[model samples]
Target chain A: MNSASPPDLLTRSGSGLLNWLHGWRAVFRFAGVAIVESLTPRTYNSATRSVVLKQIYFTAWQILPRFTLFAALLSYVLIQIVVDTARNFGLADYALEATIRLLVLEILPLMTALFVALRSGAATGTEVVLMNIHNEIQAIEAAGVDPNRFEFIPRVIGGAISVLALTAVTSSIALLIAYVVVYGPQYWNLPDFARVVAHIFDLPTLTILWAKVLAFGLAVTVIPITEALAAPKKLFFAPIAVLRGMVRLFFVLMLIEVLSLALKYI
Target chain B: MRLLEETPDAALISDSLPLRANLSVLENVAIVLQYRRNMNYDAAADRAWALLGRLGQTDSAFKRDPDLGSEQRFAAKLARALILPQPIILIERPGLLLPDTHYPAFLDAALTAVEDLFEQCWIVDYTWNEPLYAPR
Candidate 1:
């Protein structure tokens, strides 16, 4: 009974598209500001340092033990599967390379990013949304504090560092597990494993991996916070803000992963 | 209130300006000094502890916002505001922040406790609450 005319429907579609573009533009702008503020030497005072340390402790250190165990188990199982499949096809020589490419270069970083995004990203988003609703951001500003410098950028830095830390730990363990799985824990296969590692982890590959993981880390925290800041200052919008943040973050993470793969192989 | 807003050193204590829920009461109070004065964590914590001590809120130092009593939450907000250098304390609508308590008397006692820390103290409330501030 209330169907819109063609012109009205066109206008509504145009408006929705414009709003979508505006949201993306806001996210990029906020990310740029956070990056610039984080780089400024003056941002590393005692206050922000404390915030960053607490963030890292919560994001990486607190979950390190349990997450590492989980990742190790997963890596071993995956490596075994890859190795078995390769050996069945008389391609055992390519097993290590495939495992390294799959696990170390791609899977571990993505896993770590997802973990941080789910745990710390959601928490940061909810906290920020609540702060916005309660006018705490305004309060901090009124007290002569730059919430960007004092509150937000520190979290971005900490989250990025946490991602890198988790990725590094898990990736290293995965590599070790790959070796033990492929080479039976023998010291005699050390030189062969080193050769495969060096061949796989060339400068470009390493650089791309680092860039991708860093992008993942930044996206995890930055997307949530940007979305949270853009959310309406209403109690009901808190969950919506986090949901949008998480969805956007997942998209960005996948995009980065695809781009990295394209750069390395395509 | 407009005059207080015009000043750069004004520190507001209101229900709208809630303490950070993720942070403990001590962290909430100490963070002001840490951010503004660049005080180290230990020093800021010590100073915040002293401020909370002045309000007999040391027992609630490590508690977070949700865990705090109304009086303790108000004390944390007050301490956070008072930490500013030569702060002009702006206490807005005490009843909104401490609904169950006699806020006028509590504000009087709390302000009297930290009277020397602030340059001036202003209480902004609705006309309906005017008689509550009148001298008995």
Candidate 2:
């Protein structure tokens, strides 16, 4: 039905690679702007605040209960498996530490980021692409309104906060579930549990965990919006924008996880 | 639209009622003041209320955009655009906003408002054989 120029394979692949790199470059640049604007006290006026609040409501508040329940279910299952496996091998002492490190330090944050990325990040990309297609950004600019301050930055802040808040809640729930599964819901093991918690959550581990969570939070929203903006202002490019955003999100999530692990172990 | 890039004092009101549909009226106006004018929340709200009053849209301040009628929505968009101290405004598709019976009167009033606020305005209407809202 449609006839267009089909470039040679080399040119096509080369252009594709260049576009991918360009997308990442835009992401980092936008992330820089968001961080700077988010820090500036003047950027938090009524309009941007409203944007941020609406974003938080959709990304964090609306999905809180369902996400927590799901995280608890997963946590319980994982804790049971880790505890059972350790006991089977006569390694019960290491079970609690492993669970704490695995669930609290690594898995919870990654899972939270991935979940938010799939829901809110993808939605944000779609919204941004739609807005671009409709020339809303240019319209806002024509009105002397900075789209970054009013639109993109708020979404980024909301996404990051949402990821952070969800990670905290899910990780806490996972800890509770892990304790119950391992220690049989008894108060006598509180001291023991606290000791393991303190040991596994030492200064370096805690610092890395915090850094990783923050990175994940930033990536989930930032990458998608950047990808959306990189899309051509045609309706057909909307799905492609979302697809690229999601792929980048998944890659960044895994990369953060790997880097954290490498820093901790390697 | 060409004048906009050179001057920060330019405004645009679109046919789509470009204000965020999810936000309340006060929020829609207040956000522009805060982001563009660097006003605090309370100050932005105060300025927004005053602007809404100036446009005779005080009653629609808190209502959501989805609840507003076409004319009221136009008024809201105009109010947001006018929040900045812009000296030029470019209204896109002024004729498309209202019915044939209402558009002429609406354009008259809008032209009056723009004349009072801005030195120049470009009302883009493809149907007009002559400039309806020319520099007057």
Assess each model's interface with DockQ, reporting 2 decimals per model. 0.64, 0.48
* Deviating ranges (above 4 Å) for candidate 2: A1-7, B6-8, B14-17, B24-26, B38-70, B96-102, B113-116, B119-128, B131-135
Clashing pairs in 1: none
lDDT of 1 by residue, A1-266 (tens): 89999999999999999988888998889889888988889998888998899999999999999999999999999999999999999999999999999999989999999999999999999989889998888877765678998899999999999999999999999999999999997889999999999999889999999999989989999999999999998899999999999999999999999999999888
Predicted candidate 1, C-alpha RMSD: 2.2
Q: List runs of model 1 lying over 4 Å from the truth.
A: B1-5, B127-136
Instruction: Tell me each candidate's TM-score.
Output: 0.94, 0.86
Question: Please, what are the lDDT tens digits per residue for candidate 2 over residues A208-257?
Answer: 99889888989988998888888888899999989988998899999999
Q: Rate the local accuracy (lDDT) of all candidates.
A: 0.89, 0.82
Candidate 1 lDDT for residue A206: 92
